[model samples]
Target: MDSPVDNANAIVRRHRLSTRLWHWLNALLLYTLFTSGLGIFNAHPRLYWGQYGANFDHAWLELDRFPGWLTLPGHYSLALSRHWHLAAAPVFAFALLFYMLWSLTNRHIARDLAFRRDELAPRHVWQDIRNHARLRFPTGEAALHYNVLQKASYIGVIFVALPLIILTGLTMSPGMNAASPWLVDLFGGRQSARSIHFLTAFALVAFFLVHILMVLLAGPVNELRSMITGRYRLPKPRSRAVP
Candidate 1:
């Protein structure tokens, strides 16, 4: 892998095939979880601000319309939601297990994804915010593989929100809840679990929005190609006139 400075080259060091598969599978599972979770909420059909137990008039969210087209005769929305949520849960769990094992053994996980010590520095984060705000992406040799901020956000979503969603979701089921009253208490209550689920949903969506923005800023062709082909193509070198 000669440096582009030393040789005119088009090299590829793209994502591994397994990594790409995991990425796509994770996207599908997330989508399934989101829609099914929404469907489950359709039963209760109400939302409130503040904690779930706290009495409040602020019913800030709801999906009032049962889209007539999707509504099937004799089909229970709640049951359907439960079916999808439960079905998708195992798949999502398996993916996480694979990811955890793969990353733990391969060291690439720690090196590539984990936030570095310097990344947490206030000055570094501030610079990232300013740069991202202005849409000034890194370029050429200075081009970051990924800025420190991206690493932190990804790690947070994986470690915090994902586990919280999984645990809180299970707390809603009576049988599971019976066995695990501790989980209910951990989240505050059954209603509180629902509330946390909603909050985590919003956070995931927010992360998705930011992720897309970063990709667009990073150069779509480069980023997308790497994800698909497993080999990123570097920019073509400018031709030098023969002396």
Candidate 2:
């Protein structure tokens, strides 16, 4: 007979409280960034490709009139876009910094959250994929914290996407860009940076869609509780399953 504490450990480790808070807060910040970004995009109303970008004649973007109830026009204000973006930047930065620092300090950056040696095995990956496809969940065996796919996605967003977005954002500003010509040099030029920023945003949106789908497939209530409470409820053991 195990005590309550023992049982708790066997089933689920209560997630670190910090993880829960940071996760939701980051979600909020990301939403703000996304909405304000749309406003900014609407202001420009065009997208360009290649080195030499958008001229007045090159209109690759389109916008619809705001609904009459909204009492707005066909366009968004550049000033308002700048204000919202700049205002939200610090909050977004702070949330990311805190999340990264906490993850590192907590020793949560382990093989369990990263890629596992065995995960690269074709057999194992195939088995897991089959289980997921069949709705036969792998609560414990699939990697309780994070599987290889999750780790790769998370790391990419943290390192690649976040940095690219921030730098390109700064590059768009005259004052910031003036102080740092290397920013332009690294990304090729201002228009290039803008293109990169837009592409990265699209990637993130795609990632979010996949993420939400996975969460739904994994059991939304359980996933939501785990994220919110920092604790996941483990499935009950079955007699036929070997330890």
Which has the greatest lDDT? 1
Q: What's the distance in Å from true for residue 108, model 1? A: 2.5
lDDT of 1 by residue, 1-243 (tens): 123464223555757766788888888888877777776666666665333533245565655744534332224477877787789887887787787688778875676787778877899889988886787655433342567766678678777888888887787788997797788888876776787888998799899888887778666888888888776655443344744
Clash totals in order: 2, 1
lDDT of 1: 0.71
Model 2: worst 10 consecutive residues (lDDT sum): 65-74
Model 2, span 92-170: residue lDDT tens: 7777777778788887765335667888788977776776567665544332656545667888988789878888888
CA deviation > 4 Å runs, candidate 2: 1-11, 50-52, 57-75, 140-143, 237-243
Model 2 global lDDT (CA atoms, 0 to 1): 0.68
- The TM-score between candidate 1 and the true structure equals 0.79
Which ranges in model 1 have alpha carbons more than 4 Å from their true place? 1-9, 48-76, 141-144, 235-243
